[model samples]
Target: MSSAPSIPSAPSTHPAPPAGWQATFSEAVRLQSENRWEQALTLLLPLAEQMPHEASVQNLTAVLLAQHGRLAEAVVLWQRLLAADPGNVALVANLGRACWMLERKQQALEYFSLAVQLQPQDPLALLNMGAIHQGEGRFEEALAWYERVFAVDPHHVQALFNSAQLHADAGRFTRAHELYRRVLAIDSKHVIAQAQLIFTQHYLEHPSPAQLSALARRLGAQCAAQSPVFSNWLVSFEPERPLRIGLLSADLHDHPVGYFIEGLLAHSAGKEVTWIAYANNEKRTALTERIAPAFSAWNEVFRWSDDQLAARIRSDRIDILLDLSGMGSGHRLGVLARRPAPVQVNWLGYFGTTGLPGVQAVIADPRCVPEPEEHWFSERVWRLPSTRYCFTPPKNAPEVAELPALRQGALTFGCFQTLAKINPRVIAAWARIAQRAPQARWRIRCGVKSSEEDRRSLAQRLVQAGIAADRFKVEAPLERQRYLASYGEIDVALDTFPYPGGTTSAEALWMGVPTLTLSTPGMLGRQGEQIMGAAGMAENWICFDEDAYVDRAVALAQRSAWLALAEQRRAMREQVAGSALFDNARFSRDWHELVRNIWRDACEQVISRSSQGISGPKP
Candidate 1:
């Protein structure tokens, strides 16, 4: 809803307005009704000056500025008024919110803390504090503040959704799903909650791929129904002009998606394709700096709503829009649902189908979406000549040490995975491995930092499954260099099923510790397969079932087989370093071909439709 400045009667102590004040205020109101916000503010500023002591006029103006998307201006105005009356709780809370919109977290926390000090039960203040903690990865503190908000306002939807997200990130899918459903029961149309429920399904040991697709498709249909798909694109049809492609994602900073696409963005920007970045993330890391110069245009669009971003893409005349974050954090699939471009492709960021019919295609490789598994996707599969991802080797990774088993005299294994991936089924499988190879020592690194209680609970579960505390060790998270160095202690890396490793699996191969992966029927299951295939370990490492997974784990530990892997470990790093997975130049050439082919396809379809006299978007 559009809003404008509103003026209410001041107290008796304020000076009475001049005789023409009534008529002038009415004129401003009329201007506001006509959507002339600037004219309305112009008329009201003079009236506000007539009573300097009454702060209401300036406050209203600040709100108007905020509503008009001038968050920094709103913060400045709020600060100026706050100097006069520092005790104003509403003004303090407003400053916190404005600062938050500007992505100034520490400043927002300072103001929100003051607001909470003044009004102990303020839900907004409490919620903002929780959000700051959540973003910083201080999970327990975030949940505590959220609990306070619930105590004050039990049905606070935002708090519920965020708290649920904390659970989901910590791998407590059951609790997260419960909270998502609770939010849904209150407001059934919440798009992200719907997406979150489906995201949790990716981790299930035996999830119904069809059911997951049906649910995601329902979400796609709902968003499409409400979106305004652009049909009147002003793009030229001439064969040889440079094509503008927009990459939309929030993970362009210190993440797996960052590592995968940064090289491509750099290598592809030089040629006929003009790669534009719509970075949906707010935080900028070292990786962001490395990749920023690669793009022809970089837009910090974390704050752009779907309508705002869609309009911007249309205005930029982007020929193709690529979704980089997929169903993961900070995805702008809602904008894709709007059909903002002539061709939108779902690629590197997500696995499987987005379920949005508006998305014309998904970038695939022979490994990810084999011909038999093509039914899993909703969009047409545009298979690439090489791997799905082009990896950028971590600069800090240590050289592979002599295979850990040779010195230890028994097989040693490690899995550095999130708690979300280490479910009961995985634990059971590991327990079976422990029974088969009694001398096999295993190490688990729990990256889940939500609470100490959860960590202890995981350790207890391992013991309950008959793995002695002496035979296994559980460790906390470490920094990148140290984390990579730890791989030297393990002869083999154990991969989780269904929701198998993506980045960790690739890293395992890079460190010469081949991961034993269980590939199931879905894209989530195929991540390990893709990484292994790209790293040239397809036949020896990838397993199709639990029996095969167990067999491989056992077989690979035998004296002769273990020695072969140990020998391979010495050369594994350079082998993968030279493969299609890490060849940026090769990946770029493939991408150039991809962009040209998809554009040609889009142009041919448009021309065919024109010949048929068909008009409007492709629906």
Candidate 2:
């Protein structure tokens, strides 16, 4: 993402201070050390006026203000300090941090560069610089900066975590695994790192399905032991009554999760369920605005602590709480572990096991998780009958255009997933596909607009594999409507392996562009395959290996009746629009039944335990 638009500079406007500044400054420092930020700021504000020209005083005051969310004021003070002490590394670095907090990324990068130049070994400077490059889609540069930080401080957790993420993003699973191991060795209790290590295994050829189940059982046992259990009397699920349901997630805005959920919400409204949304995103978008009213109640709990959120859930007396975000950041796994509701399940927003004992099930579809694979989860594998997702196509999508190859004389194969999913192996596979269809051009649309550097780098890699530079096209990120329209430019969509496109595939199909996906043994790689299969296009698009993939693409490109098939795709939309894949009402009703059954089963267990004279500890 680019830097945010510039904001007007904050003016220096502090009044002159009283005397005896030294004693007050010391008191402020003491309060700051004690973590009493408001009290510290009260002392430091007045002291700043007495010593406006002193760098130390101004730095400390600015730090306090920044810590207290007074970013504009802190930026003013930090800039004033930097103007006087241009060579001071701390002042320069702090100014950069304040600017970054204000989303003034251009200014932040400049100051951070100055700080790094002043002290090459500074870890904070290195980390911030790496972050800036990473945000700009400059992966190699980000990796170099992270490596430098690792060299300076080998045990730097953020550096290790971020480096591992980059590797994972680039489809270097083995290297990513090694880095995550290093992180776990240093801090075993780091929950995100632990979760990531397990998640990344899905990309490997032989992901041990049992590993997630074992991790779940172990984590669940720990949660059960340390946290007080609710007495049977405290938990209730009335099978014949309207259930109070709570959904928790950070992706309830304009995202894939939102599209998948909109249908369910519309179907569930005023039904036998009273749904509440505990949203973790602070910002709202057009989609969020559209979906917000579907919930009977909406709570913006982005600022609430896990404990606070959990207590709120219990207070609401929610019968069931479905975690839309499983191991994702901002997840309230802590709250789930505390057992705020009688039933909790992991759904939509995440794949794989959450490893939380309080979570009773992971919702899936019969096609995605076979009955034999049920043992892969710690929670019960509850399969929805048709498909897990009920896709809602974007409202502003342009009408499907005729096959581009009909006019252009050569077929164009493309994918619009994030560039991170395009690893060396994926690139090599695409090279082979292009080799098979010599006349076909390759198109890639990344999440970020492709820079010239990105195009050059990609061209270098493809040319090395015998693909011509002129045969490749890299489109920049576009607005939603135009992006959907851009799909009309390609004859076929190529799915990324191990981390294949989920929403992108849906959009492609909606635009009458069939996606060719290479299915792996693991769940992550099978999403596109499942979506296409549910849409009844498995034979036309799903492949089992590189040869099959190349064969499919080449066959499609060479067909004399290619345009007939392409024109027939216009009907493909009509086929899926009301089918199981796009039927929200059916999916919603199925989900409702699934949840009710789980809750009733839990209630039955509790009743059975009570009859057997069993009692658990009370919270």
Candidate 3:
């Protein structure tokens, strides 16, 4: 939906109008302020028709029309009003915002430029201009506007948030953290700020696990206090019957979560579980269309308020709610805080603890989150037998070509993880690996499309680490087919340490390349270990420390025939296709048993509490 145009800052300076026009305008303005849209339109429509040349009447009518999704009509009205008074800063900004929302990018920029020229100090004009630049992927230019806004209004939350987001995207975590803290200091309850603050911590060089857990707990408490409670609804649990499982995620369509979830959904096709998926994705895709038929019920609840979503879950009487998005995008932590479902589980889409007390457990394997490290999580750990995820590669992937490094004399060690994962320490480790492995050139794909600045920064880091600039290539992102095929060029894949790649590792394994990972104590750092274990490649590849990590990569490269066989790709496919990583049926059975056990335990707790005449969260 299009937002209503902002009210013009400059009032009309025309001579005194005819009879009672001022009273009608005042009543109209009062109605609009109260959000009585129809009544406001009723009052303003005739006035606009009577005085077509009046700037206020035209601007007000355009705003009302824009609010109702009449963008074309509103744009025309704005143009007419601007012709009369082109100096109105708010009017120009509103016009620019509407055009931007309508996807008229160039026109929006022109209007925003005019607005900024008219009133350089206007925060709205600066913000709107920044948004236009950001939309076009000119982040540096966008930062200039946000900085200007901050200079004028130190407490402007939006300006701070946008600037922080840009910094985070560019992998400047420290600056992002500082700005996020500033936002929280101004408005502690800001949802995005709270969530992103927790997210940026993992990027720090030596993030404290205790500090992360504490932050989660604090955010959970805030959410619990703010959202409505559903303590009375716990009595709705029924243990004797089959469970109605509700899976929640925004990435239920063509994402890593979606690929892993397909196997479970397919394998559980005849199970007794009643599947209900609450999708938080704003727009539907072809992938969503394909996956929709598998679920007993699918709800597109992206627009639903937290209270409304919680009420819906309660009304559905869902026995167990599994959230795939732990701290990532499209998460409804507030809804989970209400405890609408009897049992809540945190699964994929995040690495660290959710810090939510309402979440009862997290699904994992012993390799991912060892017993000693369980204190890092707020939820109980439910370990699976082999792997936490059963990955299904895209059906359209091209046939894996012969390893390019094998045919050529030199080895190509590649990693397709994001720029954020490739920190200075990781680069130094890769440099050591390069020194040990003779004629091995590093090729790192910045998983997303990158700017020249991003590529240059990464290249500079590699150069500073005593590696020749020409020895490594920092390539921009590739299209999907080409991305999968590029793995063919690599002899071995090197995983990022501390915060390793999850889906990228899986994809590398699927494309017939072996990924070497360094496993740390934290759960966020051990996903590659679990993923490699699932593929039956962890025995020699998972490293304990930096030396071992470098040694493993050197070992893989030094061993001839490691990437030689033309049939190597086919053989790797057979191994993975039959292994636990891609075994859908096995994963489905494990998931079913786990859900039943958790549900049974929850029901038993409810029964015991009732008999003892006590009521609280399920034990």
Alpha-carbon runs more than 4 Å astray in model 1:
1-76, 83-87, 97-110, 448-451, 617-619
Report lDDT (Cα) of residue 198, candidate 1.
82
* Superposed model 2: Cα runs more than 4 Å off: 1-99, 106-122, 136-141, 204-235, 296-304, 329-332, 424-432, 449-456, 545-547, 616-619
Residues 514-537 of candidate 2 have per-residue lDDT tens digits of 889988654565787789887878
What's the lDDT for residue 557 in model 2?
77
Candidate 3 per-residue lDDT, tens place, 188-209, comes to: 8987789899977887766777
**What C-alpha lDDT, on a 0 to 100 scale, does residue 584 get in candidate 3?**
83
Model 1: lDDT to the true structure: 0.81
What lDDT score belongs to each candidate, Candidate 1 first? 0.81, 0.78, 0.81
Query: TM-scores for all candidates?
Result: 0.88, 0.80, 0.85
List RMSD in Å for every model shown: 5.3, 5.5, 5.5
Q: Which ten contiguous residues of candidate 3 have the minimum total lDDT?
A: 1-10
TM-score top scorer = 1
